[model samples]
Target: MPVTARHLIIQGRVQGVFYRNWAVALARDLSLSGWVRNRRDASVEMWVEGAAEAIEQFIAQAHEGPPAARVLRVIAQPVETEGFVGFEKRPTA
Candidate 1:
């Protein structure tokens, strides 16, 4: 299957809610490769790449993050894929 890559920005009540950890867990489970991190604007950002179906599932789930996350919106943009071995949690940017 071809890889579908995306850059996503999640907004609203995403911080302090273990959003990054949630993302990593799900992405890995979906056999995805990417990195998720927190932004200074109190939002969260991530770049994911994998099977098209996996990407779709990842984005769909991102709209409703961890139990504590109140994801108001998820902005997904198609982007060129990068070299990522596995899902990771990056320091806040």
Candidate 2:
């Protein structure tokens, strides 16, 4: 079944990388709804709502990130629902 999930990706060497944009592309391709952003601590965060399988695939991709990114870890948790219109790159927070 489809569900919502929040993922905090500790992207090693993620700064100056296009991790957020890559996440947006993957999310949109998976038909997921949510947003992705970079953290001040050099991590990438995202929330996705869609099929369980799709979300899982997205999470796996996050672990590998972009070609320039070296993902260290991924923390995933379920959410109540999708709280965004579409996949987007949000401002750092």
Candidate 3:
């Protein structure tokens, strides 16, 4: 079932890393649309909307981000698609 979801990834060593860039690449590859950004609480936040299988792949990749991030947990929730066109880094919001 094509769906939209928001994810909050608690990464132990994600800051100052290339996690965002890696995520952008991955999301683009998966053809998913939405945004990714760094949170003030030192976590990475993502919103994605696309095919179920692609979103699944995104979740799997997010767990092991950039080979430099120590992903501790990935908290996900449902969200509205909002018809995003592409993946990008959102200015901290």
Candidate 4:
């Protein structure tokens, strides 16, 4: 399977909802490598690198986000893989 990467910026009711933590857990469960963090603009940003199929699934899940997250938009863009290790939750930026 070809390794792929994507950068996602999810907006709308994402902050203070454990979105980053939830994303970290989901990424780990999907066996992905990357990091998720909260943006100062009240959005969640993530870089996910893994199998293409898994990435697709992750994107789908990210669209819905956690129960408290009212995901209004998910902006995804293809990116170069950075050879990340385990999934992690990063401090807000």
Candidate 5:
């Protein structure tokens, strides 16, 4: 499987709703490496690295985050690398 990375900006009702924790669990379930953090702009930012298919799955699931979250938009961009060992929840940015 080809490995790839993506930087995703998930906006709208993504903070304080267990979004970060949900992301970590989802990434781990997919056997991916990356980090998810909250932005000052009230959006969630994630950098994920793993099999191309897994990354795509992660993005798709992120669009429908935890029940409390109301995901408005998901902006995903190709990234070179995130240098992560395992999925983690990062400090708010």
Candidate 6:
């Protein structure tokens, strides 16, 4: 499977909703490596690197978030993988 990287910005009802933690669990389940953090602008940002299919699946799950999240939009773009070691929740940026 070919590896791919993507930067995703999830908007709306994300912060304070355990969205980052949810992402960490999902990413780990998918065996993806990267990080997720809360943006100052009230969005959740993530950089995920993994098999293309897995990344796609991650994105799909991200849209629903932790049941408390009311995801408004998810913007994803291709990025260069930094060979991240594991999925993690990062401090807000």
Q: Which is superior by TM-score, 3 or 5?
A: 5
Q: Which portions of model 6 show Cα errors greater than 4 Å?
A: none
Worst lDDT run of 10 residues, candidate 5, spans: 81-90
Error of 3 at 28 (Å): 0.2
For candidate 5, the per-residue lDDT at 80 reads 96
Q: What TM-score fits each model?
A: 0.97, 0.88, 0.89, 0.97, 0.96, 0.97
**Which ranking of candidates, highest lDDT first?**
6, 1, 5, 4, 3, 2
lDDT of 4: 0.93
What local distance difference test score does each model get? 0.95, 0.79, 0.81, 0.93, 0.94, 0.95
- Minimal lDDT window, size 10, model 4: 16-25
lDDT tens digits, residue span 1-93, model 5: 778999999999999999999999999999999899999999999999999999989999999999999999999999997578998888888
**Candidate 2 or 4, higher TM-score?**
4
Task: Quote model 4's TM-score.
Answer: 0.97
Expressed as tens digits, the lDDT of each residue in 1-93 for candidate 2 is 646566555557776788888888888999898888778888777778887898888888788888988877888887778466778888998
Off by over 4 Å in 5: none
